[model samples]
Target: MNFKHLSTSVIGLLVLSACQQPVVHIYHEGLSDTQRFQLKQQLEQQQINYEFTELATPDKYNTPHLLYFPGDVTEAYIQNVERIVKGLGFDRFDSQVFSHTGHYYTKGNLGLYFPSAYSERVLPELLFAHNCGDQDFQIHIKTNGQWTAMNSPIDLKGLDLKWEFYETFFKLRRYFDDGTFQQQVYQIKQHQVRTLQGYKPAVTYEVLGHRDYSFSLFNCDLQAIFAD
Candidate 1:
C-alpha cells in the first residue's frame, strides 16, 4: 500500500463530497411570501434533519436534488411536471408528505367524512387505526382534558369501505380495496384500551384537522380529527 497515494485520494474524496449539495427545490411559482417562509420554518424546525441547498431554477442539472412540494397541488400538476420528469426517465424525491395520508377535516364539511360518526352521535372524536391482530381502528374524544377513549364509544370493526383517486374533505379515507365498510358499535363500554404515540404531546405538533392525517408527522397515528 502506497501511503502517500492513499492520503491524496482521501483529500480528493473530501473535496468532491464538499462540492456536491443536496437542494430542496421549490417548483411552485405561485407561492406567497408568507407561505414560503412558513415552509422554510417548518422544514428547518421539524421536518428536515440535515442541511440543504435551496434551489429555484427550472434548468436541468446533474446534481442530486429533491422537489419541495407544498402538498396542495392538483393531480394534474404531477402529470404535467413530475410525469415529464419520469417520461424523461428521471426519478426524484417529492416532499409533499401528505400526498395520500390524510387531509383537513373542516367544520360543516363534516358531511364529507363524518356521516357515520354523526349518525351514531359520536361526531366529536379522534380516530386511530393500526394492526395489532388485524387492522384495528379506535375512536376517542377529549373529555374534561382527559380522553374518553373507551367505554362504549363508536367502535368500528370489519372496516370495508374503500375510496381511492383523490381525497377531498368529503372522503376521509386513506387506503382503498380493503375490507373497510362502516361498522360501528355506539354507547357500549370497551374493556380494551391502548395508547398511540404520534397524537400525544412532543410526538407531533398539536394542530387540528388535515395535518392530523399527514403521513410524515402522524404516520398511522391519529388518522383524523372528526370534530371542530
Candidate 2:
C-alpha cells in the first residue's frame, strides 16, 4: 500500500463530501428583520453554509412560507434541514416538498421561505364541501369536549378540538358501496385535505364513451391549523 496514494484518496473523498453538502439560500419574503437575523445565526451556529436572497417571482402557488429542496436531494439532507428549521418554530408540510421553482440545478441548493409569523395561535376551522359527485355524506368532528356532528363547515373556535403544534386531528367517514361506512382518522396540517380512506386510489378511470374521468375527491378543508 503506497502511503501517498492512500492519503490522496482520503483527501479526494473529503472534497467530494464537502461538495455534496447543499448551500442553503433562504428567501426572506414574509420574514421580519429579527426573524431573518436569528435564522442566519442559527445556521451559522450549526456550521451550515447559507445566504439570504430576494423572493423569486412567478410563485403562482402563493406558497411563500415553505422550505424547497431539490427534487433529487437525499432524504438525509432533507431531514437535517427540517430539524434545523423546526428549531426556529418552523413547521413543514408534505405538500411543500413539491413546491415549483425555476432554480433547478445538477447539484440543487436548498431554499426556504422563512415567514416572520406562524398561525398556531389562531383557532382552527373546518370546511366540508361536498364533492363526492353528489354523494350524500355525514361528517363528525372529535373535540376535547365530545364528538360533534358537523353538517356544514364549522369553525373550531371556542371548541375543544384535538390539535398539536403543527397538526390537527379529526376523523373522516367513507361510504362504501356495501351499505357500510368506515371511519378513518387523520392528523394533517391545517388548510389541507386528506382523501377519505381509499378514495381516489387511481389517477384516472376509463368511462364507456365520454372520456377518462379524473379521480378527485374534495372531502373537506381545514384552515389555520399550521405554523404559517
Candidate 3:
C-alpha cells in the first residue's frame, strides 16, 4: 500500500480511527464494594491512568477502543512504536502501524501491531487455576505447515497468568516475565479469519488484584484469554 507515501492529513485520520481509547470500566461483581473500592484505590495509587467508571452503566461508559490508545499500548513498549508512527508524518489519528516487541505485559519487550488494520494475530488462551503448586502453560505454533507446542510456561506462584499471539514470518514461541507466553505462526488469509460477534477487552482490580482481561472467538476457530 506504500504506507510511506501517505499524506499527513490522511495519516492523521488513520491514527484517530486506529487508536481510540475507551473508558476503563471497573466492575464490582461478586466482590464486596469495600473490596472493589480498595482495589480501585490501589490502582489509583499505582498511578496507572485509566478511565474510572461503574459497570452499572455500559452506554455512558462505552467508547471505541483501539490498540493505539495511550493506556491500550503497554507502557513498557509504546515509546519506540510511537516514535516510529510519528516519524511516518502521522499526527496521531485513526490508523497507525506498529510492531510487536514479542513481549507482553512486561517491560523491554514490545509487541507491534497496526492500530487501523484488522489483524490476524490472536492472543493465546489464558487459563487460571489456584492450585499454587507447579504448573506449565503450553503454546503450539503452526510451523513448516504443521502445529506444534513450544516450551511450556515456567510455573510460579501467582494469581494471574497470560498468553499472546502475534503475526511473524517465522515459526517460534516466546515466554514473558509476567507469566505470559507468546508465539508466531503462519498468517491466516483475510478470508480465513472470521469476525467475532461481540468482543471487548478490559482491565479491573478485584480482591485478587489488577487484571487485563479479554474474550472473543473468530467463529470458533480461536478461543483465547489472558488470565489465570
Candidate 3 displacement at residue 203 in angstroms? 22
How would you encode candidate 1's per-residue C-alpha lDDT over 1-228 as one tens digit per residue? 999999999999998755432223343222223333544565455333223223232333222123323443335543443333222222331323322334322221110011122121222346554322234455454543233334332232333322222211222232336644321111211111223422111111122233232222222233433121
Higher-lDDT candidate of 2 and 3: 2
TM-score: the better of candidates 1 and 2: 2
Poorest lDDT segment (10 consecutive residues) of candidate 1: 106-115
> Order the candidates by TM-score, highest first — what do you get?
2, 1, 3
Q: What's the best-to-worst order under lDDT?
A: 2, 1, 3
Model 1 spans > 4 angstroms off: 1-22, 26-37, 41-151, 165-167, 170-228
**Candidate 2 ranges beyond 4 A from true positions:** 56-72, 91-106, 115-227
Candidate 2 C-alpha lDDT tens digits along 170-209: 4444445576654334343322222443111011111112
Instruction: Report how far off residue 33 is in candidate 3 (Å).
Output: 2.0
Highest lDDT among the candidates is held by which one? 2
TM-scores for all candidates? 0.20, 0.41, 0.19
| Candidate that would win on TM-score | 2
lDDT, candidates in the order shown: 0.31, 0.44, 0.31
